[model samples]
Target chain A: MAPIKNGRHLFNEVPVGYPVPGKTTVYDESETIDLETVPLNGGILIKALSFSIDPYMRGKMRAPTKKSYSPPYAIGEPLNNHAVGLVLRSENPSFKAGDHVWAFLPFQEYVVQTNVAHVKLLENKENIPWSNYVGAAGMPGQTAYLGWKIFSKAKKGETVFVTTGAGPVGSIVAQLAKLGGLKVIASAGSDEKVEFMKKIGVDVAFNYKTTDTVKVLEEHGPIDIYWDNVGGATLEAALDAANPYARFIECGMISQYNQTSPYGVKNLMNIVGKRLSINGFIVSDHMTPENAKDFYDTIPAMIAKGELVFLEDKKYGLDKVGEAILDVQSGKNHGKSVIVVAEE
Target chain B: MAPIKNGRHLFNEVPVGYPVPGKTTVYDESETIDLETVPLNGGILIKALSFSIDPYMRGKMRAPTKKSYSPPYAIGEPLNNHAVGLVLRSENPSFKAGDHVWAFLPFQEYVVQTNVAHVKLLENKENIPWSNYVGAAGMPGQTAYLGWKIFSKAKKGETVFVTTGAGPVGSIVAQLAKLGGLKVIASAGSDEKVEFMKKIGVDVAFNYKTTDTVKVLEEHGPIDIYWDNVGGATLEAALDAANPYARFIECGMISQYNQTSPYGVKNLMNIVGKRLSINGFIVSDHMTPENAKDFYDTIPAMIAKGELVFLEDKKYGLDKVGEAILDVQSGKNHGKSVIVVAEE
Candidate 1:
């Protein structure tokens, strides 16, 4: 086959606040790759299927000097995250042509995957949407599942408050808490997202933009658990409404990700008086083989049975990757933001 | 028996900042108690021995409308705290005359104790100082023990950073961490207190007043556990120095106790990236019969055997109660601040 155009989003500059679509990340289509003759070197060649754009990626677009759980995106390098791709050519036995695979893929249409260690073979036995693997059956889903399972310790009739309720992780956590016989109070930025929260059977859903977070919590909670996705003001409100021995699952803090000066949380003294347990975790740390197996064995089947539902904000093509990430960061994207590079 | 003057510290006013020694709390010796005729009502007549003046009491000096783990001190009432007393007479079968008893006692020279449920008989088998019962072997000791035991999850070779390292709770926690084979980094406000930390075998002791907290922690930490006694800025420094999955035992926040505006902790975002577990607790909550048994059985013996050591800042007489509490609130007290009303 002849050389083909390969479009990608490259880290152009370090962002001070919200990453600019063109400046922080530039869409470069000047690259070309020969599909049939590109050297695999005992590796697998993959055609990018879809990309999972998450709020955590915002933390990665920083100066390399700054340390975080995730590595910083180097200037002039392809910005990467959890992405699903179709294996087109295989020089390794583990991955064959036509097999779908998932890994931390760079934002590009075609890639030569030399490191197959972290790359996982996707088993879509339930035939869920290929993009769904990057959302509900993927990192965000496992995060919600393991975090809730391991940390929630939810008892019957207890209340849980989940922030960013319409997002993938928050939505799943809210649903799980509800299934575990909890009263779910959730918040979203927009009215539409709030409606989505209600549709998903959240007991109390509110638009944080218009409503006072503390008042809502005071009315609906003395929450037993807090699934904190957006930290800052929401976390303060959670602390105010927290019942004694409240468990706080600090999954993400999207609200502070882009701020030059992070929000100063004033009421953490409540953490002592209320005996609140605040646990911050990255899902990657808990992605043991046993946990991943359990997640895959249980979650995919639930999604297929329509018991666990997830919403996706689908953005077509690799060119839209920058916009998708920005949408996720700014809470413009209503659901799990996905960049579709090619049709399955 | 003849009538005796009962000097006490009464809550005269609710304070906004630091409680005024005479205004917020007034020294009252106006009431004379007839020791023989005063009705105990089928309870015990006790002579107050010593009072524990701790930072948590500052929180209780707030307006009654505010809620907390410990109830607020009502105006025109005697300010109470963990105290040791000698029972002069007893009608209850559980206690006898001349027995040393410990309970939450008012800062008075004499008292008629009717409620004996919460009161405990102090068995000073090792012949330890009676004031030590209200300091190390009392609530602060149990707090240090339980908070460290239940929350720390510390492993050998791990590092623990303790603030207020010379206080009753911090001192015990520091010693416990050291005994558990963890590297202990402790901070105190004064040079003398830092010297005490060094005496108690803290691996790295620093005067937070003279040396920078962040600088010291950076030099010796990446701490696995933080026994947080003084919250505010020190808590921020601990967060910065935290290793992944750091355990924060939020025992107290003396730094923010008297502040009109609580410190706005800016780097709580590090909580998520570092996968920190911050747990706040009141020692009373964990003082289950079983836990209390374990604590009394283990800790008192440790202190007696010289495996654990504690220091006390003894202020003589009921008139000094207000000053003692002031010393505690201001970090002026070198050790556990105790007001000695009478000798054992």
Candidate 2:
């Protein structure tokens, strides 16, 4: 396939409401995003299909502007997080054309940035659906592996409490913990999510909206690990229900994201008292360039072993980009939200 | 000095009011207080002169408290924190009679215990004031040393924000930072403290009670290392003023100790956004028997070299122990509070 000629870029925009406007805008002139352009220099160009719409992105749109696991998004600057794409062009000596890649990318059609280290320039893109690269095969996958393997140390028979049990990272983490032979207790926002979590190997799954977080966790008995994807009241409840020396792996705090003020986790003081280790981590921080080899091997092996089963909710066409980001931020999309930009 | 052989025991209590009826109940007993003889096990005899009444002691007062830097105090029993005294007798083989040890001792005159790892058996007391074993030359000294060196990686010309700057750890840490050639900005509660800090080597000292934390910090400009003693508002202010990639060493959060419901730091989001490293540490965690010698030697040199000056706020007698603890907790003690139990 040859490179497309320069043209206007299309993006999604939102009007004020429950759903940000699902409208599209076309720029009068094409912006040169090539790495070699201006003071910036990366001939690097990746055509993104799977961009992560994480809970942290919604935090950027907060009303009073609250602090988040990730910085709040400015009014509108093409929100970015994790993305798995194919390198269409490579200026760096390390990368080659047609290479599969995963990097922190924007909710846009293309990304051409220099010095994006956490981004993995993948060698094999076969058998594994490109979508999984953003889901079970990609960052959400790594978030689970590193968090459970390193931070949480989710051991066999240990109980894990995971918030947002049906979402991307939380879902994978729950599955991984279960695979590691740990008992999983999870909190979801909706009944459907609860059922989905249970179906995917959670021992105890509850809709936090319908159940008292503390009461549900209490009924679940003792928990040794808390995977915090939803970090407001559930985090507090988990803290109250934790056994001594519990590990709370803070993947992201979706519950408190868009609120101008923080969603208070009153039991945070328990961190010091119980000798609990509550570590807030950006999954990218855990990944090294070499981790990609494990990724290329594990995703396929997990699939063959019937270990990892993941889902994707795709919003197609570049025009739907804004709506996709909105859906991603609001956490309305089930599983991972990926944008299909000129799908191959 | 002659030892008492009264064959009688006295449980004398002095009241303090911070976390609770803050009291130090000294044991004036001639009867064996050994763990085998007492109602409980694991007891050793301690001849106490100075007991450390630290900020962490407040956490122990609560029944089901958060994870702590120090061990929790048992209910209805004598509490232990950092202490300096002689071992009168011991069931624990690591200790013996007339051994001048420094421990996180019980708030008693004599402590007979089985848990000796809880105590740091002293080989050298150096004929220094017993209070120094718990104050400037002790835990606070180590706290400052470790917090600066370990967590903050304190460097020259970099700005440092130290709250409760007139207190033991803060004062010692400030001078140490000065010796390391860093730009030090301190915040305390009063004018007298401001002057004392200025006299003993603080480039900028603001009275937190008088000046605004945010404004004062901004006026001082970018802070690279924040040695937070007063958590809550001062911590929030420090967070607001910190430079990108700044390090926050949480040595103590004394400001929130007295609050029944602890306050949330409004600007804590800065930790993630700025990529700041905010670490909570108890200096005791960094010390060992081998390093304790080095720590002891270093302080004496700095003091003798006039590179460090220790400020002592003397309380008249052992009975004034209650007042000294209260004064320190309330920030009324301008410097290190020394209980003049016996004259050197």
Candidate 3:
């Protein structure tokens, strides 16, 4: 512990726009967190074994209380994500020192915890990699399942369309839709991603770079459900292709982040003709801790049954966090980018 | 019967567009529909009575097809609407000869019916005016009600915003929202229509022609539900002001109809942040004979109590039919325009 040194690194504030590499200075402690060394009843401290860098974190960099579908992260606090860690100390009966767990923990080296309500205790399984804890067995996987299963209300023999079909959330979404008996169609930015989708159960996957989205979609008529990750043009194409009474689940919009450029949609009138139903979501906004179980349980079971495909683009360490995020931002990541902060 | 003499004069082929009025010769029938000479079918024969003209008939006029939302008027056939008529004969138990009925009938001298399924019998409604069968008491009323009530899933004390607020469908939607204990905000193209909305329960009304839709709606804070009868830019403004999980019941897009032009919505990415839902519908899409009961029961009672406002901008005589159609197309009708084919 840095208690003897009188100085330790803690996260200072939420960043906006492009954060300069390594300029984010972590301080000794944040004002809100109670790091009382005396262990409180049923409380523990966890040293993070694995950390995640996700696109959802980008949503949290604004004012904490923006009344949007997603709540913003607070300023001047250590960032936290779905992290798997080893319990270093515990007063909690369920957790002991050295027991492995996946808790919503900060991007810091250590997390002090109490009331392990949102934390899921992890048992080491040799066949499953630890990075998957922040991906397939964590939030993104659950998002893929719920967004496809409930949001789309996907029907058999219907076509399911998705944007960013190679990313963590959308790739899994397409896989789950395929398992649910729907024909899967997807759009990805690169040729590699398009082919990746085909290998993973997509019926039709088009490279947006070479293909006119509307033309490609028209070739595959009557999309019944659309699971959207890239918004703007792709979403417009989805709208244009939607049959009457289509359901559009807006899981993420990688297209509409910080920029001087405008977000314009030319085909909104299609929503009226098609009687489409679209909804935006931050999975955490609607999914509670118990619901998180529903997300994890179904997908892992699906994978165990050989009914789902899962992929992760893992970056070696915390040093590559910027590169990992940049890959997602540049539409280069084939799937979810996981930060292997400290290899288990 | 003079069918052998002037069969061509009685019916017309469908004209392609506005430059050519219709495909039949304008040979005048010197003799009009006569009650004494016409052979009436025993099942039911509706004497040409008052019928309702609606905005959506423009869509029908474009092309008669299975692909379209509604079947277009057939070539060489009289135009149809919500007609209120006197039944001269009926073999069906639901009606008898000389019974007054409200049904879907054409703009002809008399309509012979072998069956009467999609119809309502007018037994003792001598107290209410016959045209009321086509206005607040008819399809337009049902369009507004079912579109907002059932589709939008609108909740009381929440905000309901509608475009084209003073028109028959939008106007009644505003009233129904008000009755449901919601705050009603509406927009109309003209200052007079704004005044009309203000007169009938609209809490806030704007002349969209004069005001910036985005600015006006932002002033109203977040909109919980948008009942969009006029899409395009007004729908865009609604999208920006929509709260998370907002429902947009898209009943019509009259703003885009006259165009050799298509209007583009520029801010549709707000669907991701706001999580808005848009559904297009014809009141026909939701109507079951059972759901029709809510309209048939509540409307007469609402009219009797003077809680519902009904307006008609009538053009007198059969010759005025062409001008009336043109006027309604121009969006110049102050309210529902009916042609008086016979004396009341």
Candidate 4:
């Protein structure tokens, strides 16, 4: 085939605060690749289908010297995240042409995968939307499933307070808690998101921006579990309203990610008096083969059977990746933000 | 028997900040009780021996409307705490005259107990000092033991950082962590206390007042477990120095107990990145019959065998109760502060 236009989003510069589009990240479509002859080195060549834009990616856009759970993105390199792609050509037996696969892929139109260690072949027998694989049935989905399964330890009739309830991970966690016989109190930034939370069967859904978090919790809670996605004031509120021995699952703190100075949580002393258990976890750590298998066998089937659902805020084309990430960081995106790089 | 002088410390007023020595706690000695004629009411009339003065008592000095794990002290009532006493007379079958017992007794020269639910018959086969029951072999010891045993999940070759390392609970936790084959890094306010920490087998002991806590932890740690006794800046430092999956046993937060505004912990975001598990507990909650039996069987024997040791800062008379509590609240007492009310 002739050389074709290949678009990519490159990490341009590390930002002091919230990343600036076109400055922190540069969209480059000047590059070209010969689809039929790109070097694979016994690996597969993939055409990017969709990319998951998440708040955690902001943590990666830091100075390389700063240590975190995820490594910093190298300046001038393609920003990478969870992406679903089509295997165009393959030399590896595990993947073949026309097979859909999910892997940590760079934000680029085409990828030449020399190492296949992080790649997993996608099996969509029920034919769910390709974007769902990057959102609901993908990393975020597994994050909610594994985190809830391993940590929440939810008992029937217990109350769970979930922050960022309309977001990918929180939505799933809230649904799981609701289905598992828990009284779910969830919060989101917007009234629309709050309505979405109510639609999803949340017992008490509120717009955190308008409501006093502590008062709401005091009136409706003494939450047995706290699924914390937006940390800061909500966390302090949760602590105030938590029942004795409440379990706090620290998944993400999207609110503080872009701040130059993180929020100072005051009432941490409640941890001692209430005998609260606060656990912080990175979901990728629990993605063992057994756990992944269990997640795939259950969550997708639930989605297919209409028992579980997820909302996607889709941004068409690679050019929208910067805006999508910023939206996720600022809580502007109402659901799992995804950049649909190409149609299947 | 003739009437005897019975002195006690009474809760006089609730203060906003630190409990005042004479104003918040008043020394009352006007009332005298006849040792022979005092009504037992199916309980026991006891002569108070030694009382444990701890920082936790500061929390009980709040308004009655405020809820806490421990009930707030009633105004104009005698202050109560862990005490080792001798039964002067007994109407209950469980106790006999002259039998030593450990119970939650008022800080008084003499006490009349109607309910024996909180009392435990003291069996000192080795005849350890009566004061030790109110310090080393008592609640503080059990607090250290059970908190360490149940929450720490410590493994050999791991590192543990303990704050308030010379205090009753932290000292025992430090020693226990040291003996458990973990690298123990402990901090104390004074140089003398740091020396005591070293003597008790802490691998690295520092005076937190003189040395920067975060610097010391960074140099000696990546702590696997944090036995948090002083929970303000030190807790934040521990979070910064913690290894992935660090277990924090939130035994106490003495530093924040008296502060009107609790410290705003800025680094709780580290909880998620490091995958930390912080568990707060009240030792009394875990004191089931089985656990209490295990603790009594093991800890006392350990003290007797010289496998465990504790320091006691003894206040000679019941008049010193107010000062003792003040000293404990301010972290002025080097060891387990106890007011010796009477001789056994």
- Per-chain TM-score of chain A in candidate 4 equals 0.99
User: A212-275 in candidate 3: lDDT tens per residue?
Assistant: 8889788986689888887777787787788888988887777766433656776666766677
* Best candidate (score: TM-score): 4
Model 1 whole-model lDDT (C-alpha atoms): 0.90
Chain A (candidate 1) TM-score to true chain A: 0.98
Worst 10 residues of 1 chain B by lDDT: B317-326
* Model 1 residue A335 distance off true place after TM-score fit, in angstroms: 1.3
Q: Write down the TM-score for model 2.
A: 0.79
Reference-based TM-score of each model: 0.97, 0.79, 0.87, 0.98
Q: lDDT of each structure?
A: 0.90, 0.67, 0.71, 0.90
Q: How accurate is candidate 3 locally (lDDT)?
A: 0.71
Cα deviation at A186, candidate 1, in Å, is 1.2
The CA lDDT at B111 in model 3 is 62
**In model 1 chain A, which range of ten residues has the least summed lDDT?**
A317-326
| lDDT (Cα, tens digit) per residue for candidate 3, span B1-344 | 34422111223444333312333212234545544455555467667567677766665665454355567766555667787888766667888777778788766656677767776787544366777777877788888877877877878789988887888788888898888899998988778888889999899999887888888788885889988877777887788888877887877777765555567676666777766666677677778877888777777778777898857887655445555665666677887777656544
lDDT of 2 by residue, B1-344 (tens): 33443221112332234622223433333344442243324446666666655666555555445344455555445555676777666666677777777776555555555677767765443455567777777787888876676677777789998788888888988888888898999988899999988987899998888788889888996799888777776777787788866877766667666666777644444544465655556666668766667788777556556677777787654445555666777888867775544332
**Selected candidate, larger TM-score, 1 vs 2:** 1
